[model samples]
Target: MTICQNVYFKLKKYVPDDPPEMGGLFGGRNGVITSVAFDQGVSRSMCSYTPDVNRMNAVIEKWNLKGMEFLGIFHTHFLGVRTLSEADKKYIKQILNAMPEYIVQLYFPIMVLPERDLIPYVAISQKPDVLIQKEELIIL
Candidate 1:
């Protein structure tokens, strides 16, 4: 998957250190990520984040106005943690289930602190053919 260079820097700026995992929704055209909708901090902890739904929905509407598609969601993982946790996986499924039938897939990137690299994945939302797998992250 491709991402804008600015998106990388923006995510970094949100989480300079560790502990409180920062995250938000990302948007773009086609399949390339070009914009981000940083969620308002509703409830964030060292290992979890609850997106501000009102803020997120508002951002989505704005992106729609700008002719961009909601691409995916991203969240940070503490240092030494390089993969999505069980809770994270569960949430991904929940998100997928919530999506409209036409929105087939969503990208999910885990930002690892200190290391500062995004490990990306794609989750397919088609029933009876559901899947979740790693995606090559291309930041440019």
Candidate 2:
């Protein structure tokens, strides 16, 4: 069997003193992984706060040239909600509508109880008509 390489996030910068909230948000721009860190207080329920389109576009542009694309999005799940929700699907549709050529990736950070470690589950979608492809987990 052939296996594909999974993409991971790299935080460009961050501010300290953020609360310990439940959620995750990250994005890749122009083929480079950036901004994978999230403000813990921004999560609500089983979903992380969605960034505004205009704001997101601005961030993508800051890291990429005009007409460049967003590669993917990543987020965390709290309270054991690891699967994508209806709202997440809607956001995926909106992202595809905004950048049809870009692949959108989603991540769920699973916190294994008792062990106290976080494991990430990743999914990637290339187009609206295609099914989301999940990458196998590999520990590094």
Candidate 3:
């Protein structure tokens, strides 16, 4: 998996101090991430972030037009906590359930830290036993 440097920088710039959690969608092709859609926050606080559905849908439509595929979702977390929360797990399950059969069955739940390092979670439908696990991130 490859992350475009521009996309990474944009995600960092989207964070607002008050909410402390900012999120968006990433678009890519052939497993290489190319673009990011910084979402309009509907409900967000220090501990949580929620992307407006209309905004998410709009981003999907816009990126689809550009020939990019949905690469999964990304959000920021308070520094020092790299593990997926219960809310994260629930959200991941929901995302997995709603995923289309034709689309990729894997979802990469990424946690962006204040230090600018990415901590990624691995989740694949085929391996239910290990639904989410932390893994090193590689950005290019």
Clash list (residue pairs), candidate 3? none
Better of 2 and 3 by TM-score: 3
Q: What is the lDDT of residue 115 in candidate 3?
A: 63
lDDT of each: 0.79, 0.44, 0.67
Ranking by TM-score: 1, 3, 2
Report the C-alpha lDDT of model 3 over 1-140, residue by residue, as the tens digit: 56878876776666653445767787888867788777645664567766566777678788889887877777777765666778777776666666666654444555546565566666666433325666556678
What would the TM-scores of all predictions be? 0.88, 0.52, 0.80
Across 4-104, the per-residue lDDT of candidate 2 in tens digits comes to 12323222122221323233344444444334434343334434445455655665666466454444555444454555666656666666556644346
Residue pairs that clash (backbone atoms under 3 angstroms), model 2: none
On the 0 to 100 scale, the lDDT of residue 115 in model 2 is: 34
Note the clash tally of each candidate.
0, 0, 0
Which of the two candidates, 1 or 2, achieves a greater lDDT against the reference?
Answer: 1
For this target, which candidate reaches the highest TM-score against the unseen true structure?
Answer: 1
Predicted structure 2: lDDT: 0.44
lDDT, candidate 1, 1-113, per-residue tens:
79999988888776647467768899999889998877634665556765666777688789989998888888777765778787778878877777677788999888887
